[model samples]
Structure formats: structure tokens, C-alpha cells
Target: MTRKTVRIAMNGVTGRMGHHQHLVRSILAIRRQGGLDLGDGTVLWPEPVLVGRRAHALDALARQYDLEHRSTDLDTVLADPAVEIYFDAQVTSAREEALRKAIAAGKHVYTEKPTATGLAGALELARLAQEKGIRHGVVQDKLFLPGLLKLKRLVDGGFFGRILSVRGEFGYWVFEGDWQPAQRPSWNYRAEDGGGIVVDMFPHWEYVLHELIGRVRSVQALATTHVPQRWDERGKPYAVTADDAAYGIFELEGGAIAQINSSWAVRVGRDELVEFQVDGTEGSAVAGLRGCRVQHRSATPKPVWNPDLPATEAFREQWQEVPDNTEFDNGFKAQWELFLRHVYADAPYHWDLLAGARGVQLAELGLRSSAEGRRIDVPEIAL
Candidate 1:
């Protein structure tokens, strides 16, 4: 069997998303599966060289995985001609410089969003990547999730005659580190460190809406720092400078309106950690991370509003579950496979650096709207 190995410099693998999703779940998983079968008697194998700031953690990960290369110096990693791709999963504050260096080195880049802390930096990366003539992509993981996949299927099949509106509920209670050791990192609560629900999630909403429903036209948002104080990973008390909750309304192209609430302070009250309810003229569907339930116009139930009477309808039972139809891989892993295919096979991939910049653009606009207390139009971004 002919085997082609693509060496990837995976920066920030010590981070959560980097370690679990990109490294273990995607790269390691692919290698464990005997490389990605490209058919035609060729197998594509990814050789990841772990890159991070922590020497101890990097050494530990490399030793545990029995990996060939690990480095704290990014320049040393990038200087290697064997490395074909530069994958970034670093904190937002540190992403731009790393990405610029990677692009300048003429390596294909794939990274987590917001690709930069601000829109300008993201656009700069996009433009630089284009100028350098290298393949680039941003992780739009939610687009590949089972719930969103099902939504896309329904949309493609014309299950939704006219997408009228979208309601998205995301996030959960991130315990303050003093007691429960907070499920999230301490940096996430500090605005100085690029931490905030709006900064974090608006990018995701932008892509999800743009790809699945429609392009976002404008946004109006209210962002709040619900948890004013929190403890860090070290149990040290700190002021929460970032907004823990953000409620946003986005006007989409084709007259579809979307409202999303992202909160780290809210306790779970729904079926999934994140859920989206899309309403169309013909039907309605509620989609979560792994489940989707739909009620067609024909099966829709009507309930009469009474001032004092108790409701007698089983509203939850009315919707039919959307079948998985096939096996679903981890969203992050699924995207990594596609990115690898794009890099090696020259496959047509749409989620480019420009698409990532649009996410940053939306996030910027969202924050602006929240600050100014008004609707701000989402101007299209270009490379």
C-alpha cells in the first residue's frame, strides 16, 4: 500500500480543544485507524509534531503517545521542510502572531476561531494566506455536528419550505473555581485575555447561521457580566471583566431572523448543552448536539390560550425524532479529515480563511452592538 504522510505542526496541543479534539480524537484517531483511506491504493497518514509553550506537558504528551516530535520553539518546528500544515488551537490572544508566522513560512494553516482576537487580524491572516498561495481553513466544528448535519439534511430536502426564524440556546453553568474548580479556564472570564461569551460564541453562531440557514445581515445584542467575580485555576479571586452572558438578535438574508443566547452563568434547563430551534413555514425542528425532533405542518398541534386553565396537551410527544441515518464521527475529527483531504487532494473546500474572518467580523459587530445598544449591520468580508 502506498502511504503518504503529511507532517503537521500542532501548536497548543496542551490546551483542551487542541489535546482532546485535534490531537487525540482527530490525529491520533486517524493514525489508529491505519490512516485515512483515500482509495486508489493510497493511504494518507498524518504525522503530528506537538508544539506548545509547556516543556513538561509537551514531553509528557509526546511520551504518552509515543510521538516522534515535540517542541516548544515554534520557529524550529516551522523551519522543518517536512511540516506541511500548521494547526493552531492557542488562546485567542496568541493566535494572530502564530498564524502570521505560519503563513509567512508558506505552510498550509488550519486553526480554531475566532482566528484572531479582532476582525482586522483575521482578515490580515486571510489575505496573507491568499498572497502566499497556501491552503487554509478554520475549524467550524458545529457545522459537522449531528444536530446541524440533520438540520442541513432537512434544509437540502426542502423539509423547511421557508426558514422563518432560528432560536439558539447555548452554554451552561461554569462553576466559579473557588469551589468546583470551574469547568472552564480562568482566562475565559478575563476580557484582557480575550474571554467572553460573545467573543467566544458569536463566531460559532455566525458560521452556523451563514451555512445552515442564511447569511447574517445585522445584529443587535445585550452582553452582561453576570458573574462579577470568580476564582482562577489557582483558586485566587479575580474580577470577571468579560461578559458571561450575551443575548443577540441577528437578521439574516432572505428575511430569516435568528436570536441566540449564550451564557456561561446559566444552569442547564434544556436537553442539550446547546440547542437550536428553527421554525419554517412548513414545519419546525429543534436540534441539539446529537438529537433532532421535528413537527411537520400536518402533525402540528394547536393549543388554545386560556387565562386560568391548565394545559392538557403533551407538547413534547408531538414531535418525531429525526433518525441518525448513519454513524456520526466527532465533529472536530470529521472536519480534520476533510481539511486533510483538501490539503492533499486539492478538494474544493468552502470554509477558508475568509469564512473565518467573517466569523470574527460578526463577533466584532456583535460586541459593538452590545456596547452601543443598537443594531449593527454585518458588512460582508473579503480577502
Candidate 2:
């Protein structure tokens, strides 16, 4: 079996996600002993061409990675005969145009979430990719989380029989870029640039809930701009045009219900981040990004609250850290490898543009729900 040396053109390589997702991950995979081995004796490795607007940064990145191909122009790389895939990690607003151009140039497309800022653009991108017969994929990293995988196993094994409800606690205080450099980009704070909790995260929840439990039938949500003004990287004040916090209730296809609280204002004081607890008739499971705890009917413990009762930390005592079963890779990098395996081995990959489009739909609908002050029925987009 011959290993495919995939020639990849990485646009937005200088951006945070671009660097981590495309450049660094690709290089790391190449340096690995077996070159990102997929199952069935197939190995996938990438030949990355760093593409960005700034020449100096591209040159510096090329030097850092020992990559010979670096480019400031996107079209030239798209026209190159060697490039097999176009990887886009640019801002949401620029995603559609760039992907459309890449598809027109006969390149397979893989990009970050939301696919586009709105449902229409996302659908159009999906349609265009289909028309061009190009492989299209969107990032869906949460589905691959260790804790989520554990929770999934519990659910699959019927540990949570007749599930009742789910509660998701996801957030951390994001520092203002003025005083402290932000982990995420500044554009995420501006609505005009396709920034908002609803748009940015709902897609993740959408897939998590749908694939893990059930499909979301409806949603009622509230959004808030907790930080109206924030400082940019230059210490200049900028108006926050997007919501930094969101509280949402999702009614799943079955009787199961879910409450999702996503915010950027909360302080970190909990277990492994982005925690979730699910209740069922037979058992209950609480999980975080790194661990999980299950309490069956036999293991259920009753407690009484008292001033001197100490903390009723059931999860802390009962939970076990989920072993890191999968091989080492960053979240974005793992997803990228999955995409490559899907492309080369014809393996099933769930992170397609339609899934990405569904995320945008959820975000757009959440906004409508907030504006209308009512529950919104999530309409299905063509897959």
C-alpha cells in the first residue's frame, strides 16, 4: 500500500487557528515515526504550503518549520498542480469566498466551523462543493473529546437508561487583549466580523447533542453582551458588537431535554472544563473534558445538607479520569487527521459542510429566538 503524500495549501496560515490547525499539526504529523498512521495500514501525511498575507511572517514560519513552500498569494497556490487540498482557517466572513474560489480551482475544501457567517452562505458553499465534486469538511472537534467519548460509551452501553435531561457548563473568563493577550482572536468580539457565542459554539453543541443523544427539535435562548467594550491588541478600546454569554434550552427529538450555558465571563473554578451532567432512570453520569463519573442505582448515595456537613462532592470522589486512549494530537490536528483518513481510505467522517451549515443555522436561529423572545423551531437545511 502506497502512502499518499497529500499536497495541502493552507490559507490563513498566520492566523491562530491556521497556524495550529494547518502548519504546526501538519509538520508535527510528518515528524512522527509513522507519519500520522490511520487504521488498516494506511498512513496520511501532508505537504503544507504556508499561505498568508504577510511575507515576513510566512518566511519566518517557513524557517521555523523548515518548509520550503510559502506564499502570499492564494490564487497561485490554487492553480498549482501539486496542491490536492485547500485548508481554510480564516475568519468566518472570509470563509465562503475563499472556499468558493478554492472549489472553482478544483481543490478539496476543509475549513473551520460555521462554514460561513449565516445559513445562506453556508448552504451555498455546500452546494458549490457538491457541484464541483470536491471533498468538503468542517471542523467538529468536540465530538472527539476524551470526556465526551467516555460519556458516549456510557450512553452506548445503556448506563444512562431512559435519559431525562442534560446540563452543560461551558465557559471561562477571557482576558481583554489590552492587558493580557487573548487566547482567541479579537474578531470574535465583533459581530460584524462573525463573532458571537451562538455562532461560534452552538454548532458544536448541535452535533454533540444530535450525534450523542438526539437531534435538537427546538431552542429557546438568551444572549447578553456582558463586556460592551474591550481593548484590542493595541490597547485601544473597541465596542463589542456580539454577545459574550448565552443561556439556551434545547428540546431533543425524544423526551430528553438539555440546558446549555456558554459564556466568556465566568471564572474557572470547576472540574475539567466544559462539563456536563446527564440524568436517567437507571443511572447518572457527570463528565468534564478530562474525566467522568457514573452513579448507578446501586451506587447512588443520599446526602443531607448541613452547615458542618462538609462539601457533598460526589463527582470528585466517584469520578475517574478517562484514560487518554487515542494517540497524541491537538484537537484541531486530530480532526485534520480524521479528514485525511476519510479522504484517503473512504472512512466515515461526520464533519461535513452540512454539519457545519447546521451549526450556522443554530446560531442564526438562536439570534432570532433572542430577538423574538420565544422558542425557535430549527429548520432542516439540505444535507
Candidate 3:
């Protein structure tokens, strides 16, 4: 009947993900977003208060967004009766403490992925959120990507009957943050800050695999640090404690096998950015970031690879770009609207902390597997 204005206090609003996901994506740029079908017919937009350690920085953001409130005090912001939702985009190591305080302060929480530095903290967060009876959610933005959504459609349509395998190729050469002024934080290469491809990305693939194909029952991985030394902004050499790349094998519940190769070392060779190719008995589909190509059983037989072959002489004539029909926003903002509706309209949003914990479980398992040189069985969390 009436519009409910949700006030959000953004923790770590000045940092990388915080600046984008909190300021640019959620608040300042949310009006242009679409795809949230809240049937009750109510207008919902998040009113945000930028919370950071520096007043001047937050004040600049407040001015840019035309927002009136900027606070250096996290406790004050959490305790404010006017703020209904607490959003945390802080680093993974800092998340649990802030989230716990938000729950104690009586505000619902929506946060970025890898909910905690370790699985124990993640489990505790989930337990406390349930005990407090608050609406809690985690960012599973990849599930909302148009390309990934199309893959979801294919799965729902049963195009790939009795799926056999899934192979994901994901990565690009990240800039050397020193001379190039690295795109990510300095701590991303440091082990103490919960930085690594295994921790940062496994949760994403866990949800992607579970949502589209099947749940991950077991995982075995080998992590490597390709470029072990890097320089910071000032030319000081820093030893990289995190993995620059990871090769993982997942055994799904339905006899499906999935392998994910995530790296920062690969050069972009194909037209697509990230690709997930699924093979089946009747047909197969290869999904990229923007398009997909399908090969039915009626298509010509596959050709063999040859070293002494030109581009056109090889397998070049069979691929086609997937038709893009639905107008999709950038993946980040799409999930933002869904989260708003999940809070306002009481809509069922699957990307919650429980889902995040599933990934944390996978990462923990992968680390254990890497350490023990054995396959680790994924343990189910009691949601």
C-alpha cells in the first residue's frame, strides 16, 4: 500500500568492493537497474549512509551521491534506529565482527561473499543470524548474469539431457598493481588478509555449479603461485602468499564431474571472457560471458586437433553466438535489486548466507585437500 524506504549503512564504503558494490552499484546507480519482479507493486530504493574510517573520504562520497549522512563511527551507525539494514562490503577478515555487531544492534544484513575468513566463522554467522531471526543475505551475483542466466534456462529446459561434464575456463591477466597501480588491494596478495583465488573464487563456482548442475560432493585441488614476488605502489618487493592460480576437480552428486581452472596468468585469446562448456548425451552447449553456442546430435562430427593447421582450416565453421533476448543490466546491480525485493516484498532470494557457507565449505575442503594430498568430501551445513 505504501512505499518502504530502506536505509542502508554501508561498512567499508571507501574500499574497492565497498566503493563499487556499496556506493556506485547499490546506491548512486541503482535507479537504472531492472529485473526485480516484485508483484505487490511497491517502489523500493535503498537510502545509504556511507560509513568509513575517514570522514573526509565518506564526506566526498556523501556529496557525490547527494546523501546527507556520513559517519566515521560504525557502532553509532549500527545503533541508529533509522538504519534498517546493515550492508558489509569490507574485507573478508573484518566481516564477522562487524556483522555480529549489526545483528546485536538489531539490523538485517546483506554482505559480499566468502562470509568469513574461515568456515567456523561462517557457520557461526549463519547460526547467529537464524537465532536472531533477521533477514540475512550474501552476494551470489554470478547467478544473475545474463550469460549465466541463459545457461540456467538451458538447464531448466533440459537441453543437456543426462549431463556428463562441466569445464570452466576463467581468468585474465591482472595488472601488476605497482607500476599499473594494481586494481585490487595490496592485501589481496597477502595471506593474512584472507586473499587468494581459492578463497575468493571457490564460493562463486560452488554456487554456480550447485545452482545449474548439481551440488559439489567432493573436491581435490592444486594451488600454485605463478608470480611469487610483486611490487607495491612504492616499488617495495612483496612476497605473494596467495595462489595466483588454482586447478580444481569437483565430483557432483548426480555422477557429474566438473573441473574449474581459475588463473590470473592467462592471456585473453577467445572472444568470450569466461566460458563454461557442458557436455551431454544428446547435445552440448558452451556458455561464455555474453553468448552461448549449442551443438545438437544432428550436427556434423567433431574434428581432430592438428598442429599444422590454419585457423580456417581447423574447426572454425561450427560456432554461433547465442541470441540475446532479455535486456540485462550489469550482473552486480541486478542482484542488488533482487536483494531489495527480498527484503521488501518478502520474496524468496536463494543467494543467502547459507548458500555462501556452501562455498566456504568447498574452500575449506579444497585447502584441506591441497594440504593432505587427498580428496576432501564436502560437508553439508545445517541450514
Candidate 4:
């Protein structure tokens, strides 16, 4: 058995998603587990070089992980012949330029979703990557979630016959920095910094619906800034220029409707922070991040309609909980392993830059639909 080391230049390792998900959970976890076995007697080892602007932060991360490679100079790292892959989790505005440089340097690239802030920019990056013959991918981690996986299994098993609709509720209150510090970054509330709920979330829904149900055909959205002002990280008040909430209705390829509500202003009243309820002719399922509950048509209870009568039946108890029969890894780590295999073992990977461009396209159209107060058709992007 041969052991191979693949050096990955990881940018934006200081950010929350980049540090927590990609660095610690995904790459380091893989290294800790003795790398990924390719099933052909060969194992792929990922050696990550942390790249970020702050040397202090990078050094701290390296010390925390007991890693040796840490670099503040991206150009020097990108030019290194030892670096095989360049992964970006930077801010949306800075992603395109960095990715362009990576592709030009002939490095295989993987990045977080909404690859760019605009559809044209995203498409151009995909085209340029193809022209340079560099393998590229974007994060679509939600598709690998345990709850969604169960939902997918039910769909594959025909448990939900003729899917009717999907309703998704995502989000919880993000505190203003006045009293309790905000959970999310302050940049998320400023539109000037490439921040908005539509751009942040529509890409997720685009792939989720496309994978679990059907491709989205059209969208009607209403975006609003529910919180006009919020305190920044420095405890200074700032006007929230970006939309804090978005209500979207999407038409799927097979005429299935999907309505999702995403908001930073909302409080949690559901079973989880995020949940999707899918109803069909034969069954219904409500899936959260880690749990899924289902109600088959045969097990559905009948109740007499009486507005005056007190509700006695336990509606929630009627549904059956789906068992966790198999162990589930972190979704981000799962996708990272797949990408590594795709790069080294020549495994088939479909979540490419083209797919990423489609996500950006959905976000672009969703914003337009909301601004125009009408349904906007989603056009296919030709790669």
C-alpha cells in the first residue's frame, strides 16, 4: 500500500466556518484518523498549510493544532510547487480574485458556496477554471446532512409518493452587540460588505431543493430589513443596510412548491433551529439538522373539526421518529473527504464550479424577484 501526501493551501482559516469546519473538523480530523483509505491499497493524506492575513491568528491556529505550515503571504504559498490544492473560505467579495490566482497557478481549487457575489463573476470563475484545466469545487455541505440523508432515503424508497410541497424554517435571533454580543459576524448585517440573507441562503436552498426534491424553476421572494439598527462588535450602533429576513416561494421542476423563511430577527419556536417539513400524497416528514420524524398515510389520525372543542389529541405524538441506524460524520468533513478523493483518485465529483455558478444564479434571481415583486424564472446555465 502506497501513502501519498497532498498539500492543501487553506485560505481564510481564521474565519468561523473556515477554522471550525474545514480546519479542525475536516482536515485535522482526517489526519488524526490516518488519512482516507482509497480502497485500492493507497491512502490519501491531506497536509494543510494555513494561509490568512493575520500571522498571529495563523500562528495561534498552528500551535493549537500542532501544525507546522502557516503562511501570511498567499502569493508565495500559491506559487509553491508543493501546494496541490487551494481552498478558499474568505469573504464573498475577495473570493473571485484569489480563486483566479489559484487557477492561474495551476492548483486544484475548492471553495465555500456563492463562489462569487454576482452570477457573472461566478460563471467567469468556472469558465476560467475549465480553460486552465484545473479541478474546482464549491461547498454544498447541507446535502450531506444526516437528517437530509434520511429524507433522501425516504424519497428513494418511495415513502413519500408524489411529493407535494416542502416548507423550510431556518434561523434564530442574532443578538445585537448592545447587551449580549452577536453570535454572527457584524459584516453580515451590512449590504455594502456583500451581506444579505438572500445571497447567504438561496444558494443553500437551490441545491437542497434540486437534490432532495427537484430543480427550482422559478422564485417569488420578499426581502426586508426587520432590524433597522444593530450594535457592532465594538458596541457601536450601525444601520443594518442588508435584508435581515427573506420569505421565498419556489416552483420546482415537477410542480412541487417549496417555501422557505430565513431570518436573523426571528425567535425559535420549532423543534430545531432549522427544520423542513415535506408533505406528499402517501406520507409526510419533518427533518431538522439531526432528527427526522415521519407520518405515513396509514398511521395518520383523523380528527373531527370543531372550532369550539378543546384539542385533546397529541398531534406531535402521532408521528414516528426515524431511528439513527448508521453513524453520521460531520457534513463538512464528509464533503471534504469526497473532494480529496476526487482530486487524487480521479473519483467522480459533480459539485463543481459550474454547480456553484448555478447557486449564484439562484441568489441573483431571487434578489431580482424580491425587488420586482414578481416571480422570476430560473434559466439554465450552459457550461
Candidate with the larger TM-score of 3 and 4: 4
Q: Which stretches of candidate 1 lie over 4 Å from their true place?
A: none
Q: What are the per-model C-alpha RMSD values against the true structure?
A: 0.8, 2.3, 2.2, 1.0
Model 4 Cα lDDT, one tens digit per residue, 277-344: 99999999999998999999999899899989899899999999998889999999999989988988
Show where candidate 2 strays beyond 4 Å: 1-3, 36-43, 305-315, 318-329
State residue 306's C-alpha deviation in candidate 4, in Å: 1.9
In model 1, how large is the Cα lDDT of residue 34? 97
Estimate the lDDT of model 2.
0.83
- The worst-scoring run of ten residues by lDDT in candidate 1 lies at 36-45
Where model 3 places Cα greater than 4 Å from the true spot, the runs are: 32-41, 304-316
lDDT of 1 by residue, 1-383 (tens): 89999899999899988999999999999999999887668789999999999999999999999998999999999999999999999998999999999999999999999898888888899999999999999999999999889999999999989999999999999998877889888888898998888889999999999999889999999999988999987889999999999999999999999999999989899999999999999999999999999999998888899979888988989999999999999999999999888888877898999999998899889899989999999888776
Off by over 4 Å in 4: none
Question: Which residue pairs in candidate 1 collide?
Answer: none
Cα deviation at 191, candidate 4, in Å, is 1.2
Q: Global lDDT for candidate 1? A: 0.93
Candidate 2: 10-residue stretch with minimal lDDT: 319-328
Clashes per candidate (backbone, < 3 Å): 0, 0, 1, 0
